[model samples]
Target: MARKLPELKRRKPSIAEQQRFILICEGEKTEIAYFKALKAQYRSAQISIEYVAPAGVPITIMDKVKARMAELRREQRSNPSVKADTVWAVFDRDEHHKVTEAIAGRQVSGAQVAYSNPCFEVWLVLHHEDYHASDDHHQVQKRYQKLDRAYDPDGSKTPDCGFLMNRVEEAENRGERQCKSREDEGMPFGRPSTTVYNLTRAIRAAAEASRPKRS
Candidate 1:
């Protein structure tokens, strides 16, 4: 008598869980466009980036972020599947008051802040070179324009994502080094600096973590 052999079934590979980040931006067009470009460049099944543009000063922006965080909390309570792993308020110190207050509020709420001195354009400039000179919003715009001729000072143009994508790591490195230098010089909250690198670092980490492991 011959024994019948059983067929083996293969198990499906497991996918990494997705992480969601909610970014509350101060600029309606430029900031939104930049973050959207970043999201597209890092497209991954396990990472989600959402943007909210309230278009206001630092204090007002924080207010909107707090409200949104509350709404997210309520949704999460109703459905555990709905989650926001990180909440970030993106703003620049462009003649706006209450910058310190906004930073303090984020600390209390356990949220993050991607703050740039003069304007967000400073972060873009770091992609090309290390900029230590103090600049106002207008000056930083010119600096960015010089580095990226396609950059528009007005909010009409979208950033060149493809161009910026290749230089992101360089920008992060320059930004971190500048910040560290400032901190060491007893000017922890000095101008000509940005914390936008922190946000981008988190995004990269989340995307990397979501990638499947190979045996």
Candidate 2:
């Protein structure tokens, strides 16, 4: 009697490119806008980013990301083929010890994390011309300089997420006055500005470069 050959167990093919996921601290409106822009800009093909709030401080956000990563690790163990390719935690370097603690914690946990330059405002410094300065500017002339000469030629613009945010507010104010008869207020945050898209693209490019390549 001829026995049928054992049916071959076909397995699903693995992904051709690695997938990436990141977590960034959620805080003020400007920071939120910058991250949103970054995600929108970089959102294509192989990478993904998400923003999560720790509800308190930068360290809290780090903890959340780490916990999420741990959960992902467990998921990968069961699937064997699926794994989180990257995890990053971003926050501002403002008047708090949180940024310092977050960095130190990541180093100790042996986890890979990412951060924005000069705090979350780094993106802001890149966009607006008036906010770029070698030193902080409190005056209204706002003689800000380009964040870096390399990124902005002719010394005309900085990423200035804050400026973008202010313009959004100005536009909203004008619209509100024009439509005084109507009560429907335009959102205070304004439309998702280009800063979100631009910064996100930068982060995506950076993440791709930083990811390990399989030989």
Candidate 3:
């Protein structure tokens, strides 16, 4: 006889849903997974969260995010009840950071958006902020030596920060690799959501606490 499979069950929503919105990120799969995890945890809460991009695209991230914020602000201005929520622009501090100023100048054109009154905000996550693999000096040295011949043919030592940021790319690549490996093995993979997860939850909790006391 074949083994019986576990029974499937459906979970019901428990909390009243509120509305909240945030700018999504522009990066690889790792970035989206983080957002999805946080969304899952807060989905039942009295909050409605919307994202700017479900598919990661670096070129349009900043522009699209700013556009979304402007749209939200415009709507909020007309409708007092509607409010601008937080925008988290998460990016990797890989080689991209070196060219970000130029990219920001040409690609992203506009003033940054701030959140609504009472409690409004923005968040930024640099590649190295959460976790980094190249912090392992041994690995960095190994990788640097391999790339030195082509990148620094003259053999002069490269700046540590620049080299480290390059290694940050390696870290990100490794993360992508790990994610792929999990998928290949038929398993789910994701980042630890302690930081973004807690931040969003705290925002919701604080908002709830500060809401006008009900009669």
| Model 1 global lDDT (CA atoms, 0 to 1) | 0.81
For lDDT, the strongest prediction is 1
For model 2, give the 10-residue run with minimal summed lDDT: 187-196
lDDT string for model 2 (64-119, tens) is 77786777788889888774556656564443566667867776554555443234
User: RMSD to the native, candidate 2?
Assistant: 16.1
After superposition, which runs of candidate 1 have C-alpha atoms over 4 Å from their true positions? 1-12, 45-54, 81-84
For candidate 1, the TM-score is 0.88
lDDT (CA) for every model shown? Answer: 0.81, 0.47, 0.39
What TM-score, computed on C-alpha atoms, does each candidate reach? Answer: 0.88, 0.51, 0.40
The C-alpha stretches of model 2 lying farther than 4 A from their native spots are 1-15, 45-49, 116-118, 128-215
Ranked candidates (TM-score, high to low): 1, 2, 3
Candidate with more favorable, higher lDDT: 1 or 2: 1
Model 3, position 74: C-alpha lDDT score? 85
